[model samples]
Target: AAAPAAPARASGEEIKSPMVGTIYLQANPTSPAFVKVGDMVEVGQTMFIVEAMKTMNPIPATRAGKIVEILVEDAQPVEFGEPLAIIE
Candidate 1:
């Protein structure tokens, strides 16, 4: 069977996962998310944390832009190359 297609956005650059793991949108449960929709981000800004094998890897933004959409929820499991958010 074919995998379901990911939701398509009107326009934006996608920030994809570099590893398969659980994605964290915030530093901790009580903290604000690293980035949210409509937030402007700069190159190299920490966008999300991918926890793999008990290690937390900070994922950085490769391009500077305003966050248009967040594709995954906090603590959600993500696959390698999975789209995490969209920046425009």
Candidate 2:
């Protein structure tokens, strides 16, 4: 008999950056940010966008939760696996 298929895994909390680039807060100067502290977020929602190699990528939320803190600031450079924001 054929083997049974593996069950699907559960989704967990995480921060996902769309691309490898500098992180910008607002679209431009004198503009508000895409996200902020104590903001409620939904799964698959765009928290921010990262620009890498002249390409803009939207960063989405992995799980639904409220933003507890922001680790990075506007116009700050971030690396992979960097904690951009804390969700709870």
Candidate 3:
């Protein structure tokens, strides 16, 4: 009998915050979140937003992948290079 194949693993890349700011999971409180764990995303897709210096900046995905982890909470403060999510 042939041996069973190994299960596919998530080679998720850790997406970090680009600046010091508050992380926004959705466009607004009433809006659905931009993404969540297990959601598939394309390159350049808006993953989240950050508010810094009174500006809202949308964060895009660097590559096409599925989200496997969310490391930050909605409206939570984040610093540059802080791991925000894991994309596979």
Candidate 4:
């Protein structure tokens, strides 16, 4: 079966994955997520971690704005250039 499409956003800048890997929304299992829907974020803020080739790489926000949506689930596999979040 085909996966459902992500909800269309009226206005927001998307944060895209830098590399193909598994995405972690939190620093650790018990830690709060780096950012969530409705949260305000600054440019360069760490938003997610993409583990590639056994290395953990922190993914930073490219623009400052309120996070409108998180497109990926915690620990989900992601592809390079995939949209991870929406900021407006």
List lDDT for all candidates, in order.
0.95, 0.75, 0.91, 0.94
**Compared with the true structure, what per-residue lDDT tens digits does model 1 show for residues 1-88?**
9999866684888899999999999999999999988999999999999999999999999999999999999999999999899999
Q: 80, model 1: CA deviation in Å?
A: 0.3
Which number leads on TM-score?
A: 1
Error of 2 at 59 (Å): 0.5
Off by over 4 Å in 2: 1-18
Give the distance in Å from residue 15's predicted Cα in candidate 4 to where it truly belongs.
0.3
Give residue 68's error in model 1 in angstroms: 0.3
Error of 3 at 72 (Å): 0.3
Tens-place lDDT per residue, model 4, 4-87, is 986666478889999999999999999999998999999999999999999999999999999998999999999999999999
Could you estimate the TM-score for every candidate? 0.90, 0.75, 0.86, 0.89
Writing each residue's lDDT as its tens digit, candidate 2 over 1-88 gives: 9889755422334474545688877676787887787889888777777888888777888888988777778777878777687788
**Looking at model 4, which ten-residue stretch has the lowest summed lDDT?**
5-14
- Best to worst by lDDT, what's the order? 1, 4, 3, 2
Where in model 3 is the C-alpha error above 4 Å? Answer: 1-11
Model 1 TM-score, all chains together: 0.90
**Model 4 ranges with Cα > 4 A deviation:** 1-7
Deviation (Å) of 15 in candidate 2: 1.7
List candidate 1 stretches off by more than 4 Å: 1-7
**How many clashing residue pairs, candidate 2?**
0
